[model samples]
Target: MPEWWTYRLEDFLLFSPRVYWRMFELHNAAVWPLQIPALALGAIILVWIVRPRQWPDLGSDRLVSIILAAAWVWVAWSFLWNRYATINWAATYVAPAFVLQALLLLWIGSLRGRLHFAADRTVRGVVGLALFLYSLVLHPLVAPLVAPLAGRPIQAAEVFGIAPDPTAIATLGLLSIGAGGAIAWLLLAIPLAWCVVSWATLHAMGASESWIPLTAAGLAVLSRLWPRIGSGALR
Candidate 1:
């Protein structure tokens, strides 16, 4: 891990635009034209692995399920951490979380069991382990590359809407209104909602800095224990 105390904001800022710009472009509006095919490919791979013996005849709309699954993962990840104010090691960890959630939700939404445990375990384990190692060893060097894109920092209480000031309220209100009410609502709601819940759950247990990992591990254990139960149970 990089020495957080030694790293300056400018160092991070210098690194983010190049890496995150590509990620943004791939995920942004201009890529909508390619989404269908990409989604279709994902669906095909999912189907091939999960329930290869019992393929569904969804025909042209097979991609719809995959697309929906991907969207759900994005929303879930954003919901998990966006409300938190700090952009430290934990924030750096969200990328892996997003990918993990995306893949699992993709499998869950398939319904047809289009992706089986063997393939799922291989992919998840490999990717998860790689991410863990990267986050551990390369974090200091790589972190600066994406630091530039970190949004304006805000107070923890302000982020959670505990003690909002007039300026903060107006700024967030404008952002919400400008992005369309629904987008704004997510920006405001998920953090205030899930973060608060996670925090409360952690606090009640008298845990602190390790809360997120503990919560994540607990969820992972639950997920594995009831693999047949589906996303609704764990999600």
Candidate 2:
């Protein structure tokens, strides 16, 4: 048997590069124009995090949490297991992780009232806000930019709730904005893993966006740690 260490990255790629791109093309068509409302809601979520008092009702943020959780489940079933898994076997395992994350979000935010977002102007909070903006507006543009650079036609832009890329990015921001704890870490595991997996996939595809997922993971960590450090709290 071949030694695992002798395996190259390409060996693990089960699909042709063209097939991978085609998947996104078909996905874009399947979810055409849902991107608009998804992007709009993402932006509103960012604004709400920045000025949470605007809602002024206790547990009102629960609505946003519910929305985010629903998105997680949506991607798990709709994109990962239903679509992407057909081409990449690994995504089948990843799909259940996304489902677990969704349940975590719902359990913590909706049932337990443990997950909440607010603006504190602390180092962490500011970083969280920045991540939120990145996921909402800037994340979609990433695909288009990488397309020409990779000598491909413009790629279908993905948005939060409607697709995995933005959903992963937005989840990073949410984890950062909420109180970081064991439960937060639990919620964070799958997204962080997805980012790493995505990094490898993009790298294999010769897309410049290859590295951005890892970068988002790093930023999410920093956003989580910065405030805790400043307050001399690390748990």
Instruction: Tell me the number of clashing residue pairs for each predicted model.
Output: 8, 0
lDDT of 2 at 113: 79
111-187 in candidate 1: lDDT tens per residue? 54332211234323233233222222232232234334433111111111111111122212222212222333333
How would you encode candidate 2's per-residue C-alpha lDDT over 1-235 as one tens digit per residue? 5598998777788987778767877887787777677777777777677666434555556766887888899889888988899998888998889988888888888788787798566666666667777877787776676675544444466677877877998888787778567877788888888898888887876666777889889888776666566762333
Clashing pairs in 1: 12-147, 12-148, 13-148, 15-145, 16-145, 16-146, 50-114, 50-115
Model 2 weakest lDDT span, ten residues long: 226-235
Candidate 1 residues lying further than 4 Å off, grouped into runs, are 1-72, 80-82, 85-88, 107-201, 204-235
Let me know the TM-score candidate 1 reaches against the reference structure. 0.24
Clashes of 1: 8
The global C-alpha lDDT for each of the candidates, from Candidate 1 onward, is: 0.32, 0.77
- Global CA lDDT computed for model 2: 0.77
Lowest lDDT block of 10, candidate 1: 155-164
Model 1 score (lDDT): 0.32
